[model samples]
Target: MQIYKVGGCVRDRLLGRPVKDKDWVVVGSTADEMLAQGFRPVGKDFPVFLHPKTHEEYALARTERKTAPGYHGFEIHASPEVTLEEDLARRDLTINAMAEDDDGNVIDPFDGQTDLHNKTLRHVSNAFVEDPVRVLRMARFAARFGFQVADETKLLIHQMIANGELEHLVAERVWQELEKALLSNQPSLFFICLREVGALKTLFPEIDRLFGVPQHSQWHPEVDAGVHVMLVLDQAARLTDDLAVRFAVVCHDLGKGTTPADILPGHKGHEQRSIALTHALCERLRVPREISSLALKVAEFHTHCHLLFELSSCEVLNVIEGLDAFRKPQRLSQYLLACEADFRGRPGYENADMPEKAAFQACFDAASKVSAAAFVNEGLKGPAIASAMADQRCRIIEQMLKPFRKNTGGTAS
Candidate 1:
């Protein structure tokens, strides 16, 4: 049996990226023969083994046929006769279909190397349409590598959408791909690619509806709620690598889609609507509580966070307490980051500073320092202690923000 290094490792290496994992394809090998060696069986549906030493995956060279629908509807055929080329042909993208031998010889049967050189993402074969997940995967790859999808590949994706292939994709699989795309270097491309292939409306209708929605030109020169969201997502990526923050930013403006047309570009009371929409979307996707919780908080209070400098000390303290900033300071910081991204996402505001963030953080720092033990030591009990804590926290915020309020000539409103 001849073993060859294949898939992402080879692709990454060719692109001068640090290889994180390695997968091997064993050509001319049977399951019995693999077991006779030291490889441990691990694959549930097909022939995959674990190397006894390195513990890396070693899947047998195999070919598959589409049977029913979705990604799971595949019939696998693996035997000693299966060629490495045949196995490569079943891959999604041409750039990922290339393999490498032990002697450092590169195999490019589908012109993966040529496509790589051209910075293009092309499909491997006509079989690419068989799996609906490939549409998401290719979009994710576009986000990760910043590569343009070939015309033919785009055509195939459109065809897949027309044939109702995307409808078969499971929610978990969709979330999995979406989470990965959000963490990519260019997360906006993921949504852009999905929109191009008409899958965004199917999978993320809430986000899709934002495309034509208008926003106040004074606050959002970009105007379109969808464009604003994409910009916010990109800015969130720039600020932090936290997936929770990025996801919150992505859903922060969902309420804008539901704005009343008679109100034109104004989006009054969108915050509560955004909170409801975020909850519904999170529930549908089975998103983790930590992510959904942060998202909900940001959706509800992002406007509060933005207007912190203009609000009263009591208002600032109320916002901070509502976010549970004292107990979970990290969540507050994440919320601020998302808010900052939103502030700077609009046209001509990309490089603008967020003084409100720093001011709010300072207020939080001062209030968080208020000793609960001090209040309890004053013979205060239960409800009395809670009132004393709120009073002290508000006083602390007032003291810290006094100078800024005076400078702006603004009263506690």
Candidate 2:
């Protein structure tokens, strides 16, 4: 029997990052044998045990079955005779396929170390198509490691996409990996990779519609909504890696595809439509209500409120006063960041070196000074009698005041 370190924990260690979790693969081991040794058996579909002392994960060297499709379809085979090489072969990417023996001798059958040195992501075997999740995983790794997928690996992914292998991935798994990719350091590459593989169409078909859609030639010299979105994503990667902020980048212009252009001319309420679309998309992905709701508000109001930043303080205050429904100070900060990214992505010489950074800094300072609770407690009673607020009157008022009441003694917009 051989116990060895495998996957990201090992990969990250080689890269000199703090190893968050360490997983061990026990070759030539069975569940019963592990249990006999007093390890706690845990994995439902596969043989996994918790080390009695360290309590770290110890998964048995097992083969898998393609019961259906996607990540969850795999049926595991845990046998005492399973080889470490066999387990590594089933992995999606070479970087993750590397393992380390007890004495720290690295195993590199697929030349994972060489690829790591080259900063390239390549599949371990052609069995890459066996699991549709590999495509998303590959994109995520690209974002995480700043590695370009090798030509052969990219070809395999494209082949899988053309063959409809990626269609087997469920929405939940797609969102999970997509979210990870979005929150990574190079999220734009992930979407670019998806676009290359033709899997973006299979995953978020809505995004596919943005491809050829035209934009205002004068304002958007970039020419199309897809290009604009890609630029915004690139802008996001250059900025923070916050999930909420990145979600805003991915979703801010979703309504553009549906806005009636010619008749309305520039299409009023595109921001509102964007929010509605964001909510529906978040719902489909089954994201948390708190995060999704906040993201929706940011998308819905970003374009509208951003224009107001150039207005007088009176106008800005009026807008902020109307924003009583928004309680989170970070909400506006996130919106400003999204707007700055969007604005910078917008094509125009005048748009460059705009006051957005100063605007965001001002808003952040204001939020630090004023708490949401103070705003709510400023002699405002429960629920506005207005029809628009009837649904959210109580909750909205409560959130508005939360920042106001805190002992920190501050007001924030």
The clash numbers for all candidates, in the given order, read 0, 18
Writing each residue's lDDT as its tens digit, candidate 2 over 1-413 gives 88999999889988887899999999887778898999998857778899999999999998887787667877888898889999998898888998998788999788888888999888888889888888888888877887888889878878888878877777788778988888777687787777776777877766766777787655565658877887887676676666777787788788777776652212447766777778888877887666676577667556544454333334344444443434555666666677677777765632475454455445434433443454365555445323223323333433443443343343333
Instruction: Looking at model 2, report the run of 10 residues with the lowest lDDT sum.
Output: 385-394
Candidate 1 residues 62-98, lDDT tens each?
Answer: 9999999987899999998999999999999999998
The TM-scores of all predictions, comma-separated, are 0.95, 0.79
Distance from true location, Cα of 369 in model 2, Å: 9.6
Which stretches of model 2 miss by more than 4 angstroms? 260-266, 309-326, 346-413
Q: State each model's CA lDDT, in order.
A: 0.89, 0.72
Candidate 2 lDDT score relative to the true structure? 0.72
Best by lDDT: 1
lDDT of 2 at 401: 36
Tell me how candidate 1 scores on lDDT: 0.89
